[model samples]
Target chain A: MDRFEYAEARLSSGESFLIREKGVNLYDGNEKTSFEGGEVVLTSHRLLWARPGDIPRGLTCLSLPLRYVVFVEEETGSTSFGFSRSKKIVLHLSQALPGKIPGPVNRSSHHYMKLSFKEGLNSNFVQIINETIQSKKWENFSPAATPSQASDVKLRAGIVGIERGIQEKQKAADESISRAFQDLSKLMGMAKDMVNLSKNISQKIRERQGDITEDETVRFKSYLLSLGIDDPVTRTDFRSENKYYIELARQLADILEEPITDVGGMMALTDVYCRVNRARGLELLSPEDLIQACHMLEKLNLPLRLRQFDSGVKVLQLHSHSDVNVVKNTALALEDQGSLTAEELAQMLGISVLLAKERLMTTEKYGKACRDESIEGLRFYPNQFLQRED
Target chain B: MAEVEWPWQYSFPPFFTIQVHNETRTKQIAAWRSLILDYHKITKHCILDTREAQRTALFNNTAIDRKLPLEGIVTILEDLARTGNAQPLDKQKHRWQIYWHTLEEWADLVYSWVQRCGMMNTVCTLYEITDGDNSADEEFHGLDTEIMVKILQTLEVSKKAELFDDNQGVKFF
Candidate 1:
């Protein structure tokens, strides 16, 4: 029979099922009852069945599985099983037996029994449970009155409790994961609403129209901060100052220092400026400061610079230009005959004015181009000297 | 407008500030130069009236409600001048002699270019400096008539060329 063919079949005292073949007959256990034929039944965590041929009246069947069944050959077995008073149960098959099995509540003397079968074994494991009825109460496993009955009962209760505890823990973890997923759905909805509000806000800022509310500004800033994306937006996270953060997370901490909807989250530079200073808020970080920071963090991230507008306009310089030496060098060459304006650079690099300026600064730092003050506006000339002179 | 892909959208304070770092400033100037050049290059026009470039939104686009003030334009012009690439035409006219090439560099390149064009011994007119059926060096693009005269005058003293004035403005003879 397939090992678990009778998994659903109940294993009662009277029930029996056909075994395709008897692989082994193990009748050595702590119990004194002995058996030799092929057929058997496991009524509970332990198996049991009527001994074939021998009549012990209502003596019921015999069996054992789950627990490690030591094959006690005689007084001499594996050296490790040495006990002056106790008989030896050779541990060879014991060693081959699977890991810890829930020990049964029992006792007995000399008759050798095999506690060999294991749980969840798809093979001969079901000779009893699959082919016969099972008593949920583990009837056949009841302890025969023994001198040490109290100690055995205590051990049994402890073992069962441990299994119960494990099941409860697993259930709790599964519940938390499911709840977190539900919260994730809610977070997505909030993000959409935030984006809409940001668009409206950005529009207002461009128009120089209306008084923005404190709450509104903070909300928008908080949203931008939320995009800190633990994955480094700029390579700055790997620099000396940020090594710690990089180890724990792939993101930069500065990115997460969002505009505080609260005073604390608000920095002397950001949250407060958005709430109080307004337009001239860029004063919080002047070009010198920005450039200094960029220079400081240059090795940290490749593309970093102090940017300028093509119209020679001074826009805020906040973005990172971690790496662009090659681009900057090319910009220098292009500056040869006709100089490129901020607009042209922006067009060429496919970056915003802010980004173009930042990159241009990186180029400047390398002496790529020089600035021109003409009616047309600040323009970049390929640093002819750097290239030609070099 | 040469679309400057701003690495970032500058929305905060000083979107009005044009940084002075040469490389960055130069790029900024070049971008403006392109815009100015394209404006004139496409319009085949001369003289960017401050009013038009600033007020008309034809040239000066107040992308963020903030128009490039005359100062902003002047600031860019100043940077270009500092880089020896361009100069101003005037206040209201806000015209720039965009040195797609620097005057000094242009002067030197012009001499060499003239030599290359087989005009080293020959005297070319002022108009010939920029406007002509010639593949001139870029340093001469939008070369101001007056500034060319000045450059040529210096060369004249150096015995590089001789000049003559005519109704067609000035001529290098």
Candidate 2:
């Protein structure tokens, strides 16, 4: 089955999307026992009843094809069993099985399949079933014609008007094409002599665009004349460009997630900025924009959060990250060497020395570690707790 | 000469580093206080110059190749002073006289020594108590003169000894 979308009433592939209503109901078929509060799905293909995430085989629920559905009728009398008004869908099948049986089978014995729904829901449901039975394909089922079609027609007319305007513009473009061909033919005949003149015109155009001095424009135009992109992205492509930027952000988030885990669930924001921009190739983002995107991730409730260290080094970390693990790791590392330098811890933790120092400081705050500041630079050791060595 | 065995942590590199965190630093200060007192007792030395201690093996462990910088030693000494176990001997506060034994303890020792030597009523010069040949067998022999004066002053304050200015000494009664 195709992946199920949570709470979506739609069906999977090979199943029909034509769901009239879906809610808790009873399926009392050939068996006297009733399945209580089971999710009843009425589709064009089958009457599928499941237990939320479970599509049980034989015991709880079953899928009865619509072809076997003999009739569907609403029993409007409110029963003491506390249905809003139970409606039963009856199916005459070629086979009787105690449990759910998938696929086509030859008839051994005939049996009836009955399912019920709550009140007021059976009217449109019966109509939908009738439509499904009469129609050749499930796609043909539609409710009564609506005014939306009329609006659709008006929209088509508006598009036609716009097409006419485009055609008028196309006519002007065709005229320009012909005039450009005439100039091209003249240039072909006088190509050798007009080269300098064409170059001068290009230079003048470059000058009109501004910022290019005469000499540099003459030099730069020569380079542009040799090569140019067909359709470089611009302001007109903002919608598509925005989509690409969002994709880049997602890619950056994915790339950083693993490295962040490898480095004990935190990474320097500036280091990530350089990495993300480099990964984007030509589409680099400014540092401020990268920070904004990180903020956006926090708002989106992604498994990432931004934090600033005491040394002012901003870091991105997993949402579940805590200092408890760092303290534990410090004690563990101390068990191996009894003492640790900031550089050594940096190597072991896959982080910078500055970050390692930060972790050590936090560890010391809890008395898990103590530091020695000597001529060899600062180092940390497991303190009273780890020293006990139980 | 029997070699004095230092604690295992003395050779540990971080032992020389100044602790920055309060909890760890508290433990570190306590450890240093004991070490300083033990070091003075073992070496029979009293004065601790911060600059000199940086090179001393007790403060800087050469075997582990870790040296406590002068600043760190000064910090530890300042903490010692705050705890009343050491007193700064100079205006610059760089020189400190470690009180492995408090002045009162030294005064008691001296009073008992005078009684044992049958000099209870005799006037003894301050130099005789510190550097004199008679005090050679005593634990306070070659004691810091300033510390000796402080000890004598304690004894005088308690009426155990009387100061005699003419002889620049104290007479025990």
Candidate 3:
């Protein structure tokens, strides 16, 4: 506990939040401490613990710098009945340095601490913490160094110095970019890390500003790209065809539900193929496999379904968009207006004219509406034959 | 006589286009049939020429800039002929003899008129029955001679009238 200093419950410059776990109890070596049911936040530079809501409220909290952590390991124990008890993470600590800030304990008998997770431990949390510690990010933040260091001081003055500095920065950026792309294998090796780095950079920018870009298309693209499917299901992952397709279908539903809704409840199968492949990154999904998975969507009772139009154009549509509902809505629109053309309906519904025509054709097929073909174009009207006696 | 009152559908643009849908086309043809009969009956028109019909007000709506295509006109006229409301005058079907009333109905109307006038056994020239002063107020006034001959032939077959040579006149029995 003496290793923990009373620090403000906020991140310092160059520090970023990594992971957080709730219902954690701090242990002073083998003995339990007063800190129970507190939240533990693991940042790039420190691990902070506070009462449930203290960190969010920006109150003072206990902080332990990553520099003090020698290593960490999981302490697992099973009861006599073979039931696992609460999991814990043991952090081996070095000696408290001299002139350190005051803490809950003046001196400690133990040189290590344990964090007990009342809820089961998340393997991901431990993995991320180990990665953060290995990165040694805390070593880069020297407390004694000022923001404007002597190394950054300009030995030369005037526009020449500014130009030289800009050139140097550009040269460094060029060298790093070239090095990253020097070999295909090297780039492949770093692709996962690059993706994580890019995500972190964007998150940091978003934290400082409202968005990374003002252009809506770029923002939307980033949003779609951000919805990545980690560890996409592949055929090799399962031995049986049925199991493979079912798993693939579930993953597709999870990734595509929001995007399909945004696109007005329907998307062409080709467009879906493109989006799924992009989200899966290098694991390109074949068209046949996509169709097979889509077929299983309904068998699994998912929220989406595969539909083929009369023209043989296949699309993925939400279950809520049944033909009966579409026909009913189209008939209402036709009745509201005396009549409608495909172009006019497209304008009213904010959809493509081709889709509007398809909708009208569906309504006509159901006998809810009729069409008039003329030089002006084909128009649709509510079916009056069923309505009128004459 | 007052001008003919057109149906509301006459002004609708799509009415000029033959609908592709079966139900819609059925109703469209029915409407066209009635409109044609009413228009011809009011105007006392006995013959319809397919080539000349395009310019007529019945087939063309200048107000809406919509004209029934030649094929659409033929389709409606064929539908009428199928139901005994019209007869193609030529093998090419270019000219049609429109009967607002069927020949049997016309025969009945002429026979009743003769009986009401106490001319049951009198010889009546075709023109006198169609254009003479005595029949001026009649529904068949100034009827086309060709159609009048057909109507008289129907009456002759029923023994209600006897037609003279060359269809010049007829004698009521």
lDDT (Cα, tens digit) per residue for candidate 1, span A7-55:
2224445333334223223433433223333334444343443334322
Q: Give lDDT tens digits, candidate 2, residues A274-370.
A: 7665554333467776676676676566777778877787888888888888778777887788788889989986788878888887788878887
Instruction: Give the lowest summed-lDDT range of ten residues in model 3 chain A.
Output: A145-154
Isolated chain A: TM-score per model? Answer: 0.28, 0.36, 0.42
Give fnat, all candidates. 0.10, 0.81, 0.32
Candidate 3 C-alpha lDDT tens digits along B51-154:
99999999999998888999999999999988778999999999999998988788889889999998888887999999998899998999999999999999
- Which one wins on TM-score? 3
Give lDDT: candidate 3, residue A379. 87
Interface RMSD for each predicted structure: 9.4, 2.6, 2.5
Determine which window of 10 residues in candidate 2 chain B has minimal summed lDDT.
Answer: B1-10
Answer with 2 or 3, whichever has the higher DockQ.
2
Query: For model 1, what fraction of the real interface contacts is kept?
Result: 0.10
DockQ of each candidate relative to the true complex: 0.05, 0.37, 0.20
State the TM-score of candidate 3 restricted to chain B.
0.96
Name model 2 segments beyond 4 Å from true.
A1-259, A279-283, A296-300, A349-354, A372-378, A384-390, B1-3, B112-122, B127-138
Cα lDDT tens digits, model 3, A99-217, are 45677777889999999998876788878888888999977886563222433555467665677778889999999888766775676567767666766766676565654456754
lDDT order of candidates, top first: 3, 2, 1
Instruction: For candidate 3, report its TM-score.
Output: 0.56
RMSD of each: 29.0, 24.2, 32.3
